[model samples]
Target: MQGFEWHVPADQLHWKRLQKALPSLRDIGVDRMWIPPGCKGMDASGIGYDVYDLWDLGEFHQKGSRATRWGPKEHLSEMMQTAQDVGIGICWDTILNHKAGADRTETFQATKVNPEDRNAAISPPENISGWVRFDFSGRKGKYSSMKYHHQHFNGVDWNETRKETAIYKIAGARKDWAKDVSDEHGNYDYLMFANLDHTNPEVRADIFKWSEWIGTELPISGMRIDAAKHYSAAFQRDFVNHLRRTTFVGNHDTQPGQSLETIIIPFFKPIAYGLILLRSQGQPCVFYGDLYGLRGGPASLSRPACSGKLPILMQARKLYAYGEQRDYFDKRHCIGFVRYGTVHYSWGLACVISNTVATYKRMYVGVKHMGEEWTDILDWCIETVIIDHRGYGIFPVAAKSISVWVNDKAKGRKSLARPFDTDIYDL
Candidate 1:
């Protein structure tokens, strides 16, 4: 699950907050947390995307502060350690396409390219001053001795000499925009700030070295590559290959007793969420903003907390969404499915979703579950569903809602029983 939202308050000491929330997150069946970028950005308030120093993860006294927007280095380390202790793996959000907040400016020959079509040059090659040099004085070459110069980058947006903002492709040997990148805006190799030239051997080596350093420094299980479309796909592939061959980071080798395959449903509303979560197929991911609500955005754009219903669905997914699956996709406005419990779980669930008005669906639970009493676990319908001798029952769902029907006598049903539910166990 995504651990943080885009609008999370910067002053909340979010690392510590996440550390405290690890236990509860695990309880809701989150095995991994995709965290935001931790590296120091251009400034203390700048999000990690505005990359200044990759090595300074809120550690060195750089970018006008000793700590990143999240928290200090110690807090991030502690949070990562806590997540590991609680059996939750951390997926770091990595930014590698561009670098921002350069230490100094340098004059270099560059050709002005049309913003709409980057391949089409608008002006002849001329000397233009741009912030393409990074000395990283605060780090003092602690983790890496390599200093970024104009040759390491492909292009920049602002030309300080002209005091104008436009796409200026750096002019040099093999300095053309990367070929394997998004076709949008003619060539999307140069996204923003100083775009890293993956073709440069020195740049690739330094990036590889940093990747290895971060892998050893932190307990990262995987990475979510940012701005992938703007960078060379071959470079990204090589980077992953390098990680797999060198360290345990990004190593996804399945171990004994591990489930082989599952899909990830990143974001969904109530009806779509129910359709995905209550099924026996993919692993549904609950969005962080959906659970805890959102802040720091326009007041009209903020979202209210959906913790009330989400946790219930998560618990249902954990306890009963398992075993043989059967889909009922007969109706247009309504659809349903049933999961025949595995031998180990022994109690399955039936889910019905209606996009329009209130509806009912007749589905089969299992022959073994014949004549069992069933009711909606979501408490959406007040009626009961009795499995006929053939193990078929008609489940009802409210208008534009979902209903998960489980055997009334199923074990562990009492654990998820609502406070107002007196007949859940008695029946």
Candidate 2:
């Protein structure tokens, strides 16, 4: 699911609604589900990305009671379990870069640096009031009693006493800035608020302990690591590899012209969704907004579900697309690929997607089924193609469309069985 869209006041009760939709999500061929950040944030209303307490997964009263805008701890757990029971892997979004909602402030020495060039020192190191301490007074040390101090952080943006926004590297910090971070704004390590120092052994140990603790407490299959480019690449590599988690590509941080508006531009659905589902590399994630044509406006705020081509694309992914892949991303406007099926599977799929206009492309499907016929499963093209002796066929695709041509042999097979569900979404 897309989780919360921009500026949507997603309440803690949303997970209860999701618990009811677990079976529906499985029916729609969601093998994995990406949930929003589960930790407590600056406020109950804010998304979990504004992380305040790592140990609080809607279980502490720190952020205006025991909830993190996705429902209470019990509701979140039940939803995860429900998804797991239906064979869906739960992918949790993790924020490890910066922290917010500090409980109190303290005096600390820091070096003032130029925002334009983080490495360039503008002022000599001096004592300044900083907001890097977190005690999590509400939780009462339920999960962890580890209170974060200014030493656990490398730098912060706002100067507490001056009430100003400027990047200040904490004094006695081992590293000036995190290495191998994004070059945006000179160094992207100090994103906002208290920047976690991955180099700090104590900080790293605390993170390790929290990661293990959460896994033992919750059912999580993978993680969506946030602000990955804002930390040490080596640290991230080690952490993800140690956890054995499946990582994805998308995140909230984007360039100047890369807003959600630009992403949802005209005719963007087919191309984006096609590339995601049709590829065999990483597991694809379908955004609920794109699935329901949810344009960013007042009317789209409550769009739970809507009829769209995503259902068909998901069905195609689950049923036919599999095995070894070949990419035909040679052209500018059109891209296509073929999936050679496994032995137990009856069908393989050849996909051709284009953004500009309709065109025909001759591609090889493999020599095993020389004379076999293939039909477009998505109906983007109705005409069938018969593979020649060379396993080559001319496939025509519609303009601004994603076409999936499945082997004729599997076209008549029964649709994949949906997991037995009670249809609780209506509740």
Which candidate leads the pack in TM-score? 1
lDDT of 2 by residue, 96-201 (tens): 9989989889888898998988888899988888888898998888878788999889898888899988899988836668768898878877877899998888
Lowest-sum lDDT 10-residue window in model 2: 249-258
Expressed as tens digits, the lDDT of each residue in 256-294 for candidate 1 is 122332222222256666766778667566666556655
- Candidate 1 regions exceeding 4 Å error are 248-268, 280-283, 298-307, 417-427
Q: Could you tell me how far off, in angstroms, the CA of residue 29 lies in candidate 1 after the best superposition?
A: 0.7
Instruction: Quantify how close model 2 is to the true structure by its C-alpha RMSD in Å.
Output: 4.3
Q: Which candidate ranks first by lDDT, i.e. highest? A: 1
Q: Can you tell me which runs of candidate 2 are displaced by over 4 Å?
A: 1-4, 173-175, 241-261, 292-307, 324-335, 361-374, 382-394, 407-427
> Which pairs of residues collide in candidate 2?
12-71
Which 10 consecutive positions of candidate 1 have the poorest summed lDDT? 418-427
